[model samples]
Target chain A: MNNNTSIIVTSEKLNLQTCYDFVKDPSCGGIALFVGTVRNHSYQKEVTLLNFSSYSSMAVKEMTKIAEQAIASFDIYKIAIHHATGDLQIGDIPVIIAVSSAHRGAAFKACEYAIDTLKETVPIWKKEHFIDGQVWVNTHP
Target chain B: MKIKVLFFGIFTDIFGKTTIELEVPSPINVVELKAFIIKNNPKSTALHFAVALGETYADDNARIHEQQVVALIPPVSGG
Candidate 1:
């Protein structure tokens, strides 16, 4: 991917503005953003918090690969994918994807593809904490 | 041959450590390495995982070598 792709995997909070600024281009007409946040409930149970961990180096490479694929398949100008690590309370942002394109359709589609592929391929894991106990979701098997 | 293996998330809890160095036969492929891991760490025998070499996922046929970083990755949920 080109330098326009901003891929970040951090324990710090994810900023929508930083991602937006990176993808914003005067040449592009539309910018699409996807923000993933922690929810209070899941599978009919209450979720108190979430813990995210990853193979950091591999996660960045996978995110870059997704961005490259988005650029290759879509008419997008730039893309930014950022994910959070460590403990996150309910409503905390876990991920943000920003895509800019000359048209709205490509931007929207690329943003979706970026996030969808990330969930499947990235080397990050999420543990949902409940008052009773906790379990890992989206087990590979 | 000594290979460095990395554990994350649940694997860390199961292994009780972040990384470990293992000695194995020289010509062991990814498949054999996985079998060795499960046999040694019986708790992981039932869980499915992907073997990663460096920044990419290594297929079963991929040859593993000494001093290489290998990660045992469970299913991902990054969003």
Candidate 2:
């Protein structure tokens, strides 16, 4: 684990300011952050809420791996990743990725890679509760 | 050998419980363990799933040992 990397999976609401604080470094010249929020609709359905579940142990492990990869792949000073579980309403933040680097290019690229890789590998699932019914998103074909 | 199986995401919905303990023969691989799970809980076969041994993702040929933490992982949708 990198000393500057922070990996968190929780049920509480995410705080963006904390993420910014975590990645703040005097030596870094630029910071990039990505915030993923619950959307109002999915597949043309009116989504009312989302309930998230995760294999906590593996989720953290995979998240750490992504952070480590980002640290090694990019010229970044620090990285922080936080994800939320349980029920969340539309417009609520579910995930946040922060990266700090000596240049804007590295910060931006590393931030994008972190979020993209996290979506593909992390063991977290979201079930959208529509007005009429609810279904786990992306579970089946 | 007794193995502990943990369910997550849609798998928990299919299994109707979070954790299950099963007794299988010794030296079982991940493929065989998945087969045993599907045989006992047929609904689990409906979704494409992967297995994780401890903190790492396990391939189908990976061997399962006694008291290892095993988890069923469905397709991920996190952002």
Best of the candidates, lDDT: 1
What Cα-based lDDT does every candidate model obtain?
0.91, 0.89
Candidate 1, TM-score vs. the true structure? 0.95
Q: Candidate 2: DockQ?
A: 0.67
True contacts kept of each: 0.80, 0.80
DockQ of each: 0.74, 0.67
List per-model TM-scores for chain B.
Answer: 0.90, 0.87
* Residue A37 in model 1: lDDT: 92
- lDDT (Cα, tens digit) per residue for candidate 2, span A26-98: 9999999999999998888899999988888789999999999999999999999999999999999999999
Highest TM-score scorer: 1
Best by DockQ: 1
**Residue A47 in candidate 2, Cα distance off native in Å:** 0.4
- The iRMS of model 1 comes to 1.5
Candidate 2 TM-score versus the reference: 0.94
Per-residue CA lDDT of model 1 for B7-29, tens digit only, reads: 88788877889999989888899
